[model samples]
Target: MALTFEFETEKVIQPWRTITSLDTTLLKNWAKQRLDDAHHYNMQSNMKERLKEDVLKQYVKSSEILISVANRHCESTVSGMFKSVLFILTSAEGIVLSVSGPQELVNTLNRNHNLGPGSVFTIQNAGLNAISISIELMDWVYLTGAEHDFKLFKEWDCFCSPVRQNGEIIGYLDMSFSVQEDHLLLAGLFAFTLKSIEEELGKQDQQKSIYEHFQTYRLSPREKEIGYFWLKNYGALRIASELGLTEGTVRNVVKKIYRKTEVSDKGQFIRKFLNGLI
Candidate 1:
């Protein structure tokens, strides 16, 4: 769905950075404008039926890492803050991939609001809500109470941040709760959650690159294994213990890896093997 809003400047606004700086009046005005446009278009308040099971499975598989991290964050951090909370992870297109939180609350939302996996939250399907707005703006958004365009969501205070990988938006991470007094603080907390997920994703990407780069050395599986641990600063005794091998064996493998990679020590090995990969 196409919803347009006129801004004072052509430059894109980074809403999260400016969120604290924006006055209450200005923030309300921005939400008001979006709600007005949503009302003008007469957008649907209720979400449509979810996608097919196979299609939904594909989305879930593609976002496996994102889903894992989001759920971990919810369980370890967000769930401790409230008795009942909903964390929703959605694809770039706004189709739900996973929902994490209290089981009863998740069931209620799925049965009553059609909010389970595969449910679409785009502007066309679910009206002007946090997920839809975040996808549209490609930034962070928080909508509370009547600020929501749909009456169904008026009781929910939702905070959403677009999950980006390699500078491209891959999905959205959203946390919603019944209207509460600490909504603003919750928004900040959600931002922290997103930041952690993004940082973890970046580290994984770096590790993957390093693994692929190692392939050019033509080392055996064992050599590669020992080399990786050695490069990470693991001592021979530690690597041997972890791999269930003798320290002498691990040291021998490490020596072969160093010679094969044309490096004498860990410092040189890292400098030569991981020059541009890291």
Candidate 2:
């Protein structure tokens, strides 16, 4: 709904709708920061291009490419850039995504730090003996794993960007370096990776919005396939035709899936799907 503007229109001069002396400077800085980040952010198409075309064509087909590319790039380009070996590792809960650095760094990580295995994490390291650890970073410790990524990286002289998947922070992508370059640049890249992956995942998820958790017990292949289609809004007729089953058969199958999943209707099923508790 459009917000009704009841205030007197004192604008005739400023371009922004809401502005005050303090807000004016803040708004300008915020806009400038956004512009700067956008410049460095790999444009959507450009990011698509970053993937090997064949790979993009293959994996992104079902939208699995989001995690694939993030993990892959971390293992390949990002890792090579860091002069490290990388892995497609998940956090303790299989929620966060991470690319652990090369051999020595990995050894270091395992030996010393847990770099957080929690949801929602942060890290920063400036090369000097003097350091600034913000409350934002500290508050995140219990929220996610920071011991390894934030604390250890600070100890080893590296920087980390924690990736959040499905609203839960999963893991941190830590890079060990000798000197500080641009932490913001690295942070921005990871941010873009997260956003791109999240968008694809969100769309894929919507397609399976129905009965994700309810049907978890023991789904037959046909039941699973039928569920996939139904969540996507495919009717019995469409699903039957697509799966080479009779409409009557598809309806029977869905009833069983619902029974197994424990949900009576599509609404409850979708709620479970989004939480990922499924």
Candidate 3:
């Protein structure tokens, strides 16, 4: 719906009709910033190329969890009825880590838009995309219709949110659909996905902490493996069979692990491992 008109004779501006009033203001500000930067929408044409190894090495470490979590969720959900949606994960600096969708959508995005894994989005290249703008604003952003700088993307609806850790933006999670049928629906989905990614990251952190606590006991790699299996309630025979060791050898290792860890029984060992005290 057109909120107002600059001139009654002029056709309604597409963004005025599509985006909320607040978002329109934000869009205008972003446009002004682009102009101020002397950045054209398509100026960074080479961004679609593979990210340099050195660049990735420098940037992807902190975002690895976000990338992994987003990729896992997208792979499981971005098919069947959701096949038209493209889910993208990009680093804080807008380096694309992965793009997931049906092959048809993937091909279309790649061929027409130069969007694929390893693509970069920056003030120089991406002109007001969900990913690019979210990077700029560090907030949730939705871009569709004429708000997109490129005509090729105007028909697609994009929803993106900043992925954060330690209260700082680490990357972005973006989903693009060919049509603008459901902004609110996609927004809810994006929020839920972000929550799930954060939860998964918490689990990863806890697991790492637990592993580090376990390492403080100076267990060898093999003993650590055996201890993990032991904590899982595997019998000595099963552990030996799985690890290709004789049962006697496995039993000896288990004894050493118990002594070194100071656990008198399986229950105590399990408790200590779970509490990260061993």
Candidate 4:
């Protein structure tokens, strides 16, 4: 689980006055050195299919809450606050986990940026995205149209901030909009939203330890079978089918599980079970 990495020596000081004077020349150069035209075309052409088998699938169990909260925030923002904003969530490594916005705005990003889950934004692949920049810079960053090195995103602006848990960066949240939108306001909003996410993640961490202790408790064979699927986030019907039992039987077992685990509802049961509370 311990992967090693090294970042190039780039200036920590940020430039505010002129786009041309920004300290991103090294990022543009790195992008050019890491990929070529064919790589770019391949990524854009097959991104949708690649999303089905992303490396982040293992992290999905814990990330579900993060993605849910972010999507809800995205829906609320786009419904009235910002008409053209598209929110993107990415893992610490820059691999996108989810994207949300109005259908028209989403479609435009898909068409132009191949925006989708499993897509990676990095200096090595795509040049100068808010998510990648924020992670690299370890701070909030707003990239305006002409500030980007990639021609594909020359007319777009982005506000990005990193999401942290236990003082370590875990992911990134990005809000992209057209050049006419208010970048400064959006960046401040992103910072506030990130703080909320960080607080939620902290609670989840506390709950996870409680659930892990529950895993040591003993269970009957049938209960163990069902619990196995439950831990994987499988639904009752799906669990029944895979275990060759009826849905009613699955539900009955779940009821017994709830009683034994001292949980009242599916949400409590699932959170505890997945976290190891049961």
Best by lDDT: 1
**Tens-digit lDDT track of model 1 for 27-76:** 56555544346664344445565899999999999889888877787676
Question: What does candidate 3's lDDT look like per residue over 1-278, in tens digits?
Answer: 76974755856433212245456677667667563242345343323345666776666675666777888877766654533677888887888877888887678767766777667776445666677777866777778766666555667788877777656677788888867477666666666767888777766665566567669888888888788788768999999999999999888988888898898889998888777432
- Between candidates 2 and 3, the one scoring higher on TM-score is 3
lDDT of 4 by residue, 1-278 (tens): 99999999977553222334446775555456445653453334223223456465865655787777767766766677635777888878777888888887677767765777777787656655666677777777778877665565666798777777778887888878889887666766666666677877776775556444545665576787786677667899999999899999998988887788888887786776554332
lDDT of 2 by residue, 1-278 (tens): 88887777664442111112234554344334332243232221111112244543443343344456566555554543643323333332222234345656555543454322221221112111111111223111111122222232332233333445566443334434433355334444444544555565556555454444434667876787888777767889999999888999999988887788787877665554445534
Q: Model 2 misses residue 38 by how many Å?
A: 38
Q: Rate the local accuracy (lDDT) of all candidates.
A: 0.77, 0.44, 0.72, 0.70
The candidate maximizing TM-score is: 1
Give each model a TM-score: 0.79, 0.35, 0.69, 0.60
Report the backbone clash tally of model 2. Answer: 10
Count residue pairs with overlapping backbones in model 1.
0
Error of 1 at 261 (Å): 1.2
Overall local distance difference test of candidate 2: 0.44
Indicate the worst ten consecutive residues by lDDT in candidate 4. Answer: 41-50
Which portions of model 4 show Cα errors greater than 4 Å?
1-33, 37-62, 111-113, 210-278
Worst 10 residues of 3 by lDDT: 12-21
Q: Can you tell me which runs of candidate 3 are displaced by over 4 Å?
A: 1-29, 35-66, 80-83, 165-168, 225-255, 265-278
User: How accurate locally is residue 268 in candidate 3, as Cα lDDT from 0 to 100?
Assistant: 92
